[model samples]
Target: MSSSTQPSDIIIGRTFGALFIGVTIAAVLFGLSCVQSFVYFQTHRDPGTTFYKLVVICLWILDALHLAFIVHCVYYYLVSNYANITAPMDVVWSFKLQILFEVLIIQGVHSLYLYRIWIVSQGRSRILPIIVGIVIMSNSGVAIALIWALYQCSMFSELNKIEWATFLTLGTITFADVVIASSLCYLLATSRTEFSSTNSLITRLMVYIINTGCLTSMCSMAAIITCAVMPTNFIFVAIEFLLAKLYVNSYLALLNARYYTEVNTDTNNSDTFHNRHGVYRPELHVRALDDDELQVSRKDLFKHLDDTVHPSRSVKEPALAVTTEMNSFSSV
Candidate 1:
């Protein structure tokens, strides 16, 4: 609790300030992209009113909100760290709200992707494939609390003592997210035809998810070891901000790359697919992953995963449906 043990707080005013500014811009760009995408989808609906379509729409909205939240955090991180170092307990409690929202952000990612993989894999896989998302969300909740402690508890020097249990709990949860995500990738990879029906969109997505998870895991490890490593200095906290910026920005890049355009070739079908109202537009199909080599590639990726899935599991008309949809929309 002594001043000597306090972290060597850096002059984060400018650094965090710049980050806040940049992320706020990114948030705006993200919002713009979301609007653009919504307009496009609203112009092209084929399957009519379906629950799955609604789910995808919800994911996009949540993602946009998540970006906005990141912008908010960027501001708070700077403001809280220096401008107002000593917040009243009630204010600190309010700050915890932002930290808790971080969990919701991550949970949004899981909910959006987990079900897709399950459906693509035909709902016939290990139970971990299904419930692992819940575990991920649960642990994220714990991480949020611990994350709050890292800041808010530090507000009260006497209560700054961190719990190892909390560390392990959150760490384990991160590991679980990684493991399940990897499994999802493998399941898709080995599915009878590489992801041919889905094009590289799904594969790109899976790779991006893997990369994000790995980086997040690395950040968590660095954080957990900070106690034994530097033990002092705002260095760890600064690193944390940097990692967070990377996580959010990288995700935005993925959104832009994955959703900003009709990357794949698949948009032929139109079932009132979000086209504002009842409208007719084409769908997009990524590319063909229907060859044996692609299948082999899939097999290789999932070599370590234990799912019994195979390339033959791929649906026969996934590409056709996508291609027809894309062509149909383009013609519109």
Candidate 2:
């Protein structure tokens, strides 16, 4: 081999090696996501959870497709075109199609977060969620444009021509993530009450939101920086491969968190009062809270404590008043 050809060979190896590592990590995360989805379905059987179940199903399907495309792209370059020096420079169809799946998965997760923000604020803070929604939609638009541009490119070098689209797509996503995390943290912080248990739960939620948001944002930022610094390298493409899986797993993680919250609350309130009158009294109230509709108001908390402390008061007739309040956050 000529001396000059060694540099190109090293680059090809690095590119495919990065692709392999990214896809491997993505597959691991996808497996975790599948487990989370199964747990969600098994634990939450109420009819109200149909929407969330559907969301999980849809995202999982999209993630499967995305992974398949990535595998095909890697196979095309590394296996199908083995020993061909020029193969790395050519673009494959799967490489272009995966962007669409990524955009859809990301949008789905973002929309769910936006819904949570709206619910946490009890529809009072409408402007922030709306603005975030607009930004998310704009990001999706740029991602579509980026996919179209990728489709137009026949060579790896051609990606440089559409750097703007790449930057905008990643930039908007990171921005939205930051905004969502900050908003959730700020809102939850403000909703904190004097109760130690409630405050503790709120703190846990804030920490979780911060961690997940930072994770996805950091991945996006890394992709943007790598793409800008080394447009010819496959490092950015590898990062892109991981982005969708991260979002999907994040969504599933959030959903599955309800189980932990429930267990903790139950352990803490093990001696909770149950009506002993057995006259169909409206004293004991136990309700299952949905993940999306997890709201705990101060009034409800005070009422629950009051009922628990003073269970002597009973209903005049055979009446039942059941109120479902999530143990986690009163306003999360």
> Which model scores highest in lDDT?
2
lDDT value, residue 92 of candidate 2: 85
Measured against the true structure, the TM-scores of the candidates, in listed sequence, are 0.53, 0.77
Best by TM-score: 2
Candidate 1 segments whose C-alpha is farther than 4 A from its true place: 1-94, 130-134, 137-141, 144-159, 163-166, 194-206, 218-332
Q: Give the TM-score of candidate 1.
A: 0.53
lDDT of 2 by residue, 66-97 (tens): 99999998889789988787777777888888
Which regions of candidate 2 are displaced past 4 Å? Answer: 1-10, 47-49, 271-332
